[model samples]
Target: MTLSRDKAIIGAMEILSELIIIALLSIAGGVIAAMLPFAFPPAVISLFLLLLLLFLGIIKEDGLSSSSSFFLKYMAMFFVPSGVEIIEYADLLSSSWFHIILISAISMLITFFAAAKAVEITERLMQRRKAA
Candidate 1:
């Protein structure tokens, strides 16, 4: 009983630490965004900072592995608030549904085409490297 309790305590502590790290990084991004003159989203800055830290080896993937996995596993839940807000705008959506659907479909097709072209280019470069 004591051993299991200790293990549970340790696991909780690790989860807390992971949350703290993520919060701190987000706060750091907000601070940087505030210091800048122009308007910019703090979340975007935060993501960039996180990527920079990972690339510079300041933060290792393994350290955030568990928390990252947990977040990704339920990421759809994070969008629940936005989905709710869309419900609030049901009138606007209903009136412009056709336009919205058309734009969304066109944008999706463009995005898909761009992604496919990028993959093709990358594969061609990789093949050339292998040949040489």
Candidate 2:
């Protein structure tokens, strides 16, 4: 019983530490966004910062694996607030539903085309490398 309790405490501490690391990165990102001239989302800045850290070997995937997994496990919960907001604005959305749908469709198609071309270019480059 004592051994299991110790393991549980260690596990909880690890998760807490991982969460602190993510929170610190988010705070740093907010500071950077505030210093920038243009408007940008702090969350996006945080993600980019995290990506840079990972690429530069300053942070390891293992360090974030548990926290990331925990987030993914409850990802749907994150969307709940958005869903509530949409419901709150249902009348406005209903009025502009067609225009909203049209824009969404057009943007989705453009994104798909862009992604397809990128993949094609990447494949060609890979093939060329193999041939060389």
Candidate 3:
């Protein structure tokens, strides 16, 4: 089904409203983190705020539907901070290139084996269940 112009406008408004509320809540969480002595990463703070909202029933699954996809899709927009900081410390990363490469290779191999084992175990279990 196609969304008519009026329906599209309404949908856009609803999405905007959801986004404004989420953004305000996130900002509030950030403010709380700033007030506390211990540092909480923004990601953790936002997650905690989301959990609280979910538990309090202020926001439910519907509120986090396709509308939330906009924020999620653009989340990489916030990655500039990480990129800048990493670039600033590029020398340190360069110094550990060999170690990083070794760790990556080992991790890749381990992940491949674990995934293969998981698939085999799951298929066997499913087959047994089907037989029963």
Candidate 4:
């Protein structure tokens, strides 16, 4: 059997509305984080809240498809600031390239292992839930 993908035809208003909703949620997340004494990154909290909203069907994927696509398409552009920072630190980075590479590779491996284990655990739990 052949699989077909459904392409969502998104309009400008839909993109705008979705962006507004996301912005409001992010602002709310930031406010909540600020009110707490703990050190929590507002952006991560907002993203987690967004994921929860999507999972709960409070925010439909279609509603944010256009905006998400727009952001994803220009995701590389988001790294410009980081690129500039790296350039500014070129002297330090060049001197410690070996150490940087080693740490990066180690961190990457750790992250990969963590993500794989998480997925495996989640799948096992899902299977158990289904079996029950």
lDDT of 2 by residue, 1-132 (tens): 999999999998989988998999999999999999999999999999999999999989988889999898998999898888898888999999999999999999999999999999999999999999
> What are the per-model numbers of colliding residue pairs?
0, 0, 0, 0
Per-residue lDDT of candidate 4, residues 91-119 (tens digit): 99899999989999999999999999999
Task: By lDDT, rank the candidates, best first.
Answer: 2, 1, 4, 3
Which tens-of-lDDT digit does each residue in 1-132 have in candidate 1? 999999999888888888888999899989999999998999899899889989999888887888999999999999999888998899999999999999999999999999999999999999999999
* Residue 88 lDDT, candidate 2, scale 0-100: 84
TM-score of each: 0.80, 0.81, 0.60, 0.68
Number of the predicted model whose lDDT against the real structure is largest = 2
- TM value for model 1: 0.80
lDDT of 1 at 45: 93
TM-score of 3: 0.60
Off by over 4 Å in 2: 121-132
Error of 4 at 16 (Å): 1.5
Error of 1 at 3 (Å): 2.6
lDDT of candidate 3 at residue 99, scale 0 to 100: 99
lDDT (Cα, 0-100) at 77 in candidate 4? 97
Least well predicted 10-residue stretch by lDDT in candidate 3? 61-70
lDDT of 4: 0.87
Candidate 3: count the clashes.
0
